[model samples]
Target: MAKIVDYGAFADRLKAAPNRWDVLREFHEEWGYAVRPGSDRWDRWTEDEHETYVRALSGEPRDEDGLEGVDLALPIPAALDEWWELPFNSFTHDSQHYETNPVYPPTVRPDPSGYGVAGPLQDDSDLVAPDADRRVCVFMAENQYCNEWGYLAAEAHDPDPRVLVSVDDDRWALQARSVSEFFLQLTVQRLPRTLGWSAEIYDGEEIIDGDEDDLRARITERMPELGFEPWAELQQDTIVYGGPDVLAFVADGELGGIAFAGRTPRAVLDLAERLGVKLTEEDLTEPGEY
Candidate 1:
């Protein structure tokens, strides 16, 4: 979500400006948005009222007025190909720290205990080695951890920095604080603009002469029209034809096929007899069974 700025800070920035209009201008300069106060009988204004008008000020390119007409007040973040990195964090006195001290040292000194033989040697020394088994959850965790503990390690490590690549994620996180922000932004930007951009071309349409349903009806409604007996087999989105002394016609939208039935052993001979029509090749291949 876009970080919420303090309204008091916003108001303070505009305090020097003369009137509400100046405040609106300064507000836009601070955060790319406008706010308008609500109205009851349609005569009211508030600090946030400017948003109502300025929000409609579009940034879309216009040829007649050129850049002057472009609405720079629109809150849409400029599209960035790369992700913006939020600061890891700030330093504080009460910040959590993980540390360790030796309870007892070796009886015989290997390196620094410096004793021949003893019951147990107590040494006050801190272990500053970083843990190697911490699994990173988010992309930012890697950089944040590196910023904190890059120096201490058993094996030398070079943490490769990463960034969020998706534009959709960046866009929504700017508009609102929800998963539905993308949908809302798209709706607000697209739905109202569809007045000039709509799919009116396909409003009224006609089907081709060999419409799947029509073709099938021609075979079954009058089998003698094609010199055969009537039959129909309906599958999911598919219509098949079969009967005595008939060429089975399978029709599915643009895809149609005719195969030989009862009297014909080969489909080629049947098609040869009933020539002058489109035929689709039969697909005998089965899926995944192979």
Candidate 2:
């Protein structure tokens, strides 16, 4: 179950710690969260690492109207400062690839090069932008860990407002609201369920070679009637389909496990029903509701 984190108590501890690193270590140890080796010590930034980050920020190509260098105020939430080094997937329930070992926040660079998802601010990027003016912060965590390619964002500049938003292949959807709330939902409400859909089957399930062919035929036959066209290529274990209202996923040949794009979760659920798969309420929920 997701423990209700006392943000007040956490902040107080961070302020009282003689060595912030030591406090972070203790937090991770107690929580069963994994931290990247070097990242655990944020005070030890190499000259090159600092320079690279500075260069990335200074060299950020921007339009005349675009904001320069992340415009948010510094000294972000204390919990985020202490916990950023920990792997997001470590907190996930049934993460396949990122369960035991996961990527660290330092692996991401905060350069505003592409449209958040493609280049400088991808899911793996270390930097998280908190532009309240724009009402979004992209690259908050890995898409795989959250079952949707998304970031911690807010729809409006209201008090205590945030949401999990997924944006893939130009399609986007609000997955959940607030980081703490999302964690509670995932760990408490949806315990034992896999984080997101993927191409590989889990729990000793066997894949039938011809199942992929059948699934593809079904999609090709029904997608048009549902008001979408197959757009991208059918990569190794994933299929990218849909145009304006896009739906993409990494599916096993038999559709045993899958991950769909953010904006089309309901549509994907409908499609799954048509494909003879019945998803539960836990399988997909509306934004802001578990």
Candidate 2: residue 224 Cα off by (Å): 34
Compute the lDDT for candidate 1.
0.23
lDDT of each: 0.23, 0.35
lDDT of 1 by residue, 188-276 (tens): 22221121111110111432224545545555553422211111111111222333322233333233343223222233234323432
Please identify model 1 stretches exceeding 4 Å from their true place.
1-214, 224-239, 244-290
- Runs in model 2 deviating more than 4 A are 1-69, 72-75, 85-111, 118-132, 141-161, 167-171, 184-290
Q: Going through the candidates in order, what is the number of backbone clashes in each? A: 10, 5
Error of 1 at 255 (Å): 8.1
- Lowest lDDT 10-residue stretch of candidate 1: 86-95
